[model samples]
Target: MDAAPMDATALLLADSRFPGGGHAHSGGLEEAAARGLVTDEPSLASFLLGRLRTAGALAAAFAAAATGGGDLGALDAEFDARTPSPAQRAASRAQGGGVARAARRAWPSARLDALLAAQPRPHHPVIVGLLVRDPRDAARVVAYLAVTGPASAAVRLLGLDPLGVNAVLARLAGEVDAVAADAARHARTAPEDLPAPGSPALDLLAEAHDRHHREEVRLFAS
Candidate 1:
């Protein structure tokens, strides 16, 4: 059977070429690489899998909820609560701010204006949810980005083959879809009740990366 048509907004946002400043963030992969935790394809795969289950899942759920609609302030607060590390929260908002700027120019709407009015720098997933609209599509876009950014970082940091990295992403397609599906299931769930899957290791990595970024020259912002 043929695949269902992808939402256009989801496709555009998920594109690596999107001028969303995502290329400057490694989704914590930079720190993981520095620590040798993700030095090779096998290790990278493991890191991506763990990240997908935790941080990725959390992002997907929030994106789904945002797409389904609710109190934007409540959603922002709930998302902030789930992100324990201050550095991680900063990175999220930074990315969100970038996407918001591009989105306002490309797809100006009352919904987008309301979101920015409520929280000028909304969480990345929440902004994505507003842009994409479809719960599953929004979830899938963020969930895909959650790993792809890091995967690309692996290629640049570890000198891994691009083909190999693409293959690794291909291998994880099922997991990504599963995460998006689970997130869509709770699209209309109360903001306070959204999934808050935590990744202590990622949080630590993000904090460390922030410190290192400040003290020395770092390639990616986060």
Candidate 2:
């Protein structure tokens, strides 16, 4: 049987040209590339897979929870606790703030207003969850973005073939769907009970990147 239609909002948010400031950030790929960690298609696939299982899963769960609906502030606080790196947190909020701004103009609602009011710069996944509403769609959007942003950055940073990078992402499609499905299953879980799958390497990379970004010129924000 054919799959259900994709949610329009999820598609829009997942689009690279969504004007959400996602282009400026590399989702830790910049740091990994600078360290010569992700150089080609095979290595890129490994990096994306590791990221999808850890950071991607965490974001997906939070996004799913947000879509399921609960106290926004509590959710934000829980998300904050899950994020160990200050730089990573900053990137998330910065992206979240950007999405929130666009969402205010494109899809205004009391829920959005309240989210911004409580925390002007909430976590990126949280904002996505609020906007998408569908637990599966919200989880899918964040889970997809988790690797795609870094994959795009890989193209620019490594000068690898775009086709090769796209193929790598295609190969990871099953893993992404698995993560989104797992996240959707816990959409209605309590805020504190949400999963916190940590990525120590990514966190370290984010911190290193922040330091390097301050010391010299860098292409992506984080």
Candidate 3:
């Protein structure tokens, strides 16, 4: 694909406004904020970085892998293996189903429809990967999601300056590009060989949030 077209596609997929159900989720920032781990800008930045490195990297790899039109069912299973938290898994599938519905309307790909019908609720990264044809663009989409979701959450949950939060995302843009490049390199690798980086703290937060938020009303979904 041409550079301009590739970037445009990536931008469309990365847009938070794109009906991907991302607004409902905070990438576990809600739980961290409730626990006082991300009380301020610096702490929030730390949490975002940790998420970008672990969850972000893994999502990018699987997204890149999906761009190649590999076995999406197997890829979804691999994503489940990487994600230990059932709540997190459900959130991913929720977002995935939403994105799949939107992608069918916006992009209208037979492959996307088939994948969605087979899994019903594929992982978020998998649907995103199948939307864009370029593996690099797919990686970029996942990397953008990794930071933007939490950044938005910080603004709503902590009342932090939106400008400052955007700045945090801007500062990490280079790192996002680097992570996407690394993930793109592993597109041809076996799905099992794809990175399975996990964040124990985030997983624990998700589990706790799932249980606690059942009774208590929470702002974010997960």
Candidate 4:
């Protein structure tokens, strides 16, 4: 029997089809691919792997914290500081703002919706943390978001076969599982002790994409 509270429901919320504005963001891969930071399938795999390894790690921790009902304010601050580039920060907020708008209207969780309205929009992951039923599920939510959101965006950018992307994601299913487990474990940390967000290159990419505007536009602006 399924033991998870809102497990099926959470899956629905995180589904790419929810129209929560995730479709609009390419997770900086659009910019990376155009700039040749990512070109072929191997590069695509590597890029996702890197993100899953570091940013994914931070996200896991944050989700865990959220599930655990840790200090959201501190997590919010940590998220802001970790995101160094102004443009990437803007993009993150943009995505967050949109998601907040949509989720508030559709799902209507009092705790989460109230938090969304509290000003200085909570980071997307944090906002997501609020909607989910428990603090322990944050990492799973992040993994679901990380995999689906980017994979959906990648389909639009690369014109790569859809089946291939699904296959790729499936291949990394173990990695995703591990990442989620780590994030959940880290969420157990004292709010003060949560791991800082890593991956300077991603921040740099978002910042660079914001400036190096050209014809081949991908939505990931720093």
Q: What is the TM-score of each candidate against the true structure?
A: 0.98, 0.98, 0.96, 0.86
Clashing pairs in 2: none
Clashes of each: 0, 0, 0, 7
Q: Where is model 4 more than 4 Å wrong at Cα?
A: 1-6, 213-222
* lDDT score of residue 26 within candidate 3: 91
Model 4 agreement with the true structure over 151-215: per-residue lDDT tens digits: 66677777877888888787777787787766766655776677776788887777767777543
Query: CA lDDT, every prediction?
Result: 0.93, 0.93, 0.88, 0.70
Question: Candidate 1 lDDT, tens digit per residue, 1-222?
Answer: 115777788999999999989999999999999998888899999999999999999999999999887887889999999999999999999999999999999999999999899888999999999898888889999999999999999999999999999999999999999999999987889999998999999999999999999999999999
Model 1's lDDT to the true fold?
0.93
Q: Which ten residues in a row have the lowest lDDT in candidate 2?
A: 1-10
lDDT of each residue in 110-215, candidate 2, tens digit only: 9999999989998999999999998888999999999999999999999999998999999999899999989998788999999999999999999999999999
What is the per-residue lDDT of model 3 for residues 1-222, given as tens digits with 9 covering 90 to 100?
A: 224446676787798888777899998999999989999889988999999999999999999999887888889889999998999899889988888778777888789778977998899999888887688789889988999999999999999999999999998988888888888887787887788998999899999899878989999889
What lDDT score goes with residue 167 in model 3? 92
Measured over all alpha carbons after superposition, the RMSD of each candidate to the real structure, in angstroms, is 1.2, 1.1, 1.8, 2.8
Output the worst ten-in-a-row residue range by lDDT, candidate 3. Answer: 1-10
